[model samples]
Target: MTAGIGHPMETQGSGAPGAGGGAIGLDELDLSIVHALQIQPRAPWTLVGSVLEIDPVTAARRWARLRDVGAAWVDGYLSPAQEDMTWAQLEIAVNGARLMDVVRTLCDDAGVLSLKQTSGSRDLVALVQARDVDTLAEYVSERVCRVPGVQGARVHVITATPFEGSQWRLRSLDAGQRERLRQFDETRPAPGTPVTAEPLRPVERRIAVALGTDGRMPLAALAREVDASVATTRRALGRLLNSGRLALRCNLARPLTGWPVSAMYFASVPAEHLDATATALRTLPELRFCTMTAGPHNLFLDVWLRTLHDVHALEAHISRELGHLRLRVEERAVILRTFKHVGRVLDRHGHSVRSVPINTWK
Candidate 1:
């Protein structure tokens, strides 16, 4: 049971680590550097240089800056079933005084991938990836539960995830706006209207691929892959990120960490009352994901349960809280396998980052 005091707010940022050194603010060059790296983390400097049309040394230095800020990183995503592993998310409630201490231990766990200190009923949320279901149970039942002053720890096994990550869609930004993007290097601007339904181009697609692979490639290296100049590549990335098209961050699946149960809760609310109902569900401590979709059921909540009992309790709690509205439970389909992610089909899309393949770099 997650026990906390404050209401949960809708706030999310890139989960990937940022450059730790506060040497200087970001600029267009840094963004370009990130864009190129995400597509091809291991790409050669010579190839990247060609993409940015700059020499190798310049590209390397820019990449170093991005890394220093913890803005981006690259790592392999080992499949859970194939790798003989199990994963889950741990939602914990702790006294405010011991929050940091608990978080420190949680972060130190070898199995833990990502940890977030959040508001609402739970003080800390963690994504744990382990070798097997047994490992997941031990990590939560023994290691995490042993923390001092811990009220409770909830673990949820992730059966399947239809979508995750920051949802980086670079389909917005026209050529001109993209050109202007090279001027600013920050990850995102203040909140604005969502940008969808726009067309994407070749360079943008390549940049997205590059960032998908590395998120921290040197400008020269990135340029070589896309066959563009460092100046041009940097501008394109800046535009993509600042405009919220491409997100450069680490996406560690919760299953990788150990909490594995995946369930969706549907609440029936009348049209006029939808807003309030959604607001209430958002405040729920166990609800990690919520959405207002187009269907007979307007409100949907995605939750990860630590144990079988918690699963029943979660549903019961929702029913008790919103029973007046006639809530419904729609079980989410288990993820037997994941063939594609972030637009990259592991088997098919891995080879080509662009819609049309061009051998210009070679």
Candidate 2:
């Protein structure tokens, strides 16, 4: 499975590394550790060390350091089952003085899954989830707009999530390492199957809470957190995995990976060619996030690149290839800072610093 937002493998570093002087630095070994975990997020340190030709204790210590400084992390969240769930992307215009207050209020709401401060006409962007269309309308129209200082709000209902944060990878691992790591990876269910919403049991909720902060938590430790036998916890986890109710993401520090710039594009595409267009865009490695939304601009894309110059090249490529689909660029927004991704809160440098579990049913 791909790493989710903020659920990246820990990279050993002192501080933000790529900025040079004053930023923490990462060596090749640190990168190797990260690549290994990206391939197999829950691999034991001993096994990971063996693959990297290091001692287990050394690997553990390196991870601890990375985790302590918010350099790397792993997180878990419930995936969208085949249920009647509504996912909406919101663009909120807020007063400058009350921006922080508005952000805090939205962040506390369980419906808001991800929040980002961006450079564009909108002051903030939020990804929210609700049970159905009416509930989503209530949250966005009544609740979000009612927040103090929220001057305006635009809601984009996500009709199809062609790609998500979890599918994006660092592509740092070699074929051999990735092949070896796959042996320990868990199996995910095939996509497109109709899934009904099943309320999580109390024990399951506790387990999800524990895993949200650390996807690699030992099964024994997870059992203790939920106050259940290891066997029982493992069985429940297996059920959750088989049902595609829970997802574990292995994410990384993008700055260290030489891809620092992130840009989001909103475009309008012809309805007849929407599926074909989304299918083609999915193959591009640069795309980290893509979704089909119902709004003035129906197609949304988030891409990461090595440099700012690459954005132009990407735009040109899109125009040249999908131009026949009549995809019109509406707006482009550069992510200024990400406060929360998935269920984890990030620092200015895009490090996973903390967790606030998402309640999809809430």
Candidate 3:
């Protein structure tokens, strides 16, 4: 296995690390830990160990390694449909010299969740959520297009996300396999105290991978596939569900349903008043997301709307809220295709055998 290939992937960080910073190397154990967590982030070490048949000490060591390396993190993801909202992806065309500035501004806004600098016709890609079309337009025209350095922008409203996050079940690392991955643990510490009494083994990983691929499989089928009893399979799956690591939801595309106008806009706001300004921006019904960030301009926001009139209303409201903030509308762009979504796993190398109890947050 290559470096960094076996682990659960991390979000691309800022070019520079924060105060205490460094890069993490991937090993076989890290891969196994990641694969198990991917199945259920909240799983207890005891259960994981039991499932894998390893003592708690080894499992704890593996889990700690993954955390230290930043291979995995727990985060929340809510379905837009659950809240009666819509999701969209935006592409912004900006002056190359000011690309970083543009991205920073968008990050500070709350509505904007994730941003990336890309190597295509567009310089930045953003994700935004909104309640309706009018608010989305207001977000674009009044807040985004007017940003000082922006040239243009486009929006591709997300229709559905069939699959997202679930990387652990895809990994295949046993005690022996993990040893092989330790290419150079020169100063690695001697194994320490137990962090938990359970961890997933190779067989458990096999069960997880099966579920990750298809959450709707019948219990009998899953038991047969994983070579476990029906009762055991049910228990394991229940633990995974309670863990917050595995989630299943409906995926739908908006374009196929009739709402097809994907719009983009820009805005320029001042740094000091960015928070207040973004707060006002969110009051509109159309906006799904917004934020403030480090950039030439103070704030960046994105929204998705369906009609021209609604867009006009949202823009007018944003302008009125800014009063004399001297914000300018910049650029907007749309998306035509998606290579991947949130939860799709990037690597598929290993499996686990044991079952573990999961730790879930309320």
lDDT per residue, candidate 3, 1-362, as tens digits?
01211121232111222112443444544445544544444455665566566786897786654333323333323333232345566667888788657755665454564455544367767666555666766777776777767887786665433222221133244555344333322122335522222444444445555653333356688789889988777666554443332344211122211222333445666656655665555444344345443333234444444444545555665666566765665544343322222322111111111111111111
Worst ten in a row by lDDT for model 3:
346-355
Residue 190 lDDT in candidate 2: 42
Error of 1 at 216 (Å): 9.0
lDDT of 1 by residue, 1-362 (tens): 22312221112112322323223343444444444544443455565566666788887777654443433344223222222245565667887788767755654454554455543455665655665677678768787888886778877665432233332211222354334433334333336735443544567668765554455566788888888988777666655654444544432222321233444544456766666665566545445555454444455465544444566677777767766665666443222222223323221111111111111111
State candidate 2's TM-score: 0.85
The alpha-carbon root-mean-square deviation between model 1 and the true structure, to one decimal in Å, is 16.1
**TM per model?**
0.45, 0.85, 0.43
Q: After superposition, how far is residue 353 of candidate 2 from its true place, in Å?
A: 2.8
lDDT of 2 by residue, 1-362 (tens): 12122222233333364222246667777777777776677888878888777899999888776666667777777664334367888999999999989977887777788898989799999998887899888888799999999998889988888777776665556688778777774333345544445666777777766787788899999999889998888867766665667767776666766667788889989999898888888777778788888889988898886567766777777877788888877788888877888877766677766677777554
Q: Report residue 239 deviation for candidate 1 (angstroms).
A: 35
Candidate with top TM-score is 2
Better of 2 and 3 by TM-score: 2
TM-score of structure candidate 3? 0.43
Q: Residue 336 lDDT in model 3?
A: 33
